[model samples]
Target: MEATVASLVEHGWAGTTTTAVAQRAGVSRGAQLHHYPTRAELVIAAVQYIGAARIAEIREQATDLPTGPARTAAVLDMLARVCTGPLFHAALELWTAARTDPDVRAAVVPLEAVIGRESHRLTVELLGADESRPGVREAVQQTLDLIRGLGLADLLTDDGARRRALLADWARHLDARLGS
Candidate 1:
């Protein structure tokens, strides 16, 4: 799965062949085929696998999060890291592929919906957000969208300094809104 995600990040959707993944993983082509019979299946499964792993990692990290004013900033920082990580890159590749490929789109749309919901839920939990309040839910979703845009921008250039500055501003606004 690591090899598959790495392939997607490095080579993109068109280049991430099962044979290539097998080669990178040091496994036989037959072995790879045994698990994923088609490229769509392989790509979809890889994205799902890596996405789940990344979410698990974020949950584990959330345990030691700081308290008080700094906590919101820390949560934003953690979310930024996640949005820029390999899993997001892999998902981006799949999304690009899905734009023109109906089969891939059929698979990725629901998969992304699930992942996005999970990510949103996790963010709300990590930030101790109360969605019952006015605009709180939209604020959280906007935070994810903003971070995703930053992640997309980072794909071309570093975008780190700018991302940090923007996220800091966002964290302040979010902290006030969420009362975290």
Candidate 2:
């Protein structure tokens, strides 16, 4: 699964094949085929696997988030890091493929819905966001969208310094909006 994600991040959807994953995984073609017989199955399963793993990692890290004023910035920073990692890159490859491929779209839509829901729930929890309050839910969703947009921008260039600046400013605005 790690090799599959690595392939997606390095070579993208067009180059991630069962054979390539097999070779990268240091497994025989027969073994790779036995586990996942087709490219769609392999890539989809790899994304699912890594997505779950990364979410679990984020959940664990959330425990260490600072209390009080700094927590909002910390949560934003952590979520941004999640959006910038290998899982997000691998998922981006799948998303691009899904744009023109119906079968891939069918698979990716549901997968992303689940991931998106979990991410929103996690973010709300991390920031102690009161979604019951008017506009608070939209604020959380907007924050996720903003980070995702930043992640998309990162695919074309290394904009870490700029991204950090933007996110830091966003954190302040968000904290004020949320009354955090």
Candidate 3:
């Protein structure tokens, strides 16, 4: 799975073949074929595998953060990191490929939905915000959307400075609204 994600990020979805993944993983081609009979299946499994690892990492990182305004910043930082990270890039590659390939789209959409829900749940938990308040969920969703857009910009060029400025501005607004 690690090899698969690395391949996807390094080479786009078109280059992420089962043969390439097996070679990178140092596994026999036969073994790779036995495990994943089709490219769609392999890609789907890799997506799910990486998604699980990412969710676990997010939960683990959130565990140690002190709850307060600090936690809010930490959570935002974590989300930003995820947006700009290799996993997200690999997922983007998959999404782009899925657009033209019905088989890939069928496998990716449900997994993407699951990951999206999990991300939202993680953000809400880490934010420790009062969900009872109106607009809280919408605010979080908007923050996510902003981060995703920034991350996409990063794919084209270095946008760290801009992303940081935007994040800082959003953090202040979120702090005021969410009260932490």
Q: Which residue segments of model 2 deviate by more than 4 Å?
A: none
Candidate 2 residue pairs in backbone clash: none
Candidate 3 weakest lDDT stretch, 10 residues: 65-74
lDDT of 3 by residue, 41-78 (tens): 89779878877877777787677777655666677888
Q: Per-candidate RMSD vs. true structure?
A: 1.5, 1.4, 1.4
Each model's lDDT: 0.86, 0.86, 0.84
TM-score of each: 0.92, 0.93, 0.93
Model 3 stretches with alpha carbons more than 4 Å out: none
Which of the two candidates, 2 or 3, achieves a greater lDDT against the reference? Answer: 2
For model 3, state the Cα shift of residue 131 in Å.
1.5
Residue 131 lDDT (model 2): 88
TM-score, ranked from best to worst = 2, 3, 1
lDDT of 1 by residue, 30-83 (tens): 888898888778867876787677778778768888998799999988888877
Error of 1 at 149 (Å): 0.9
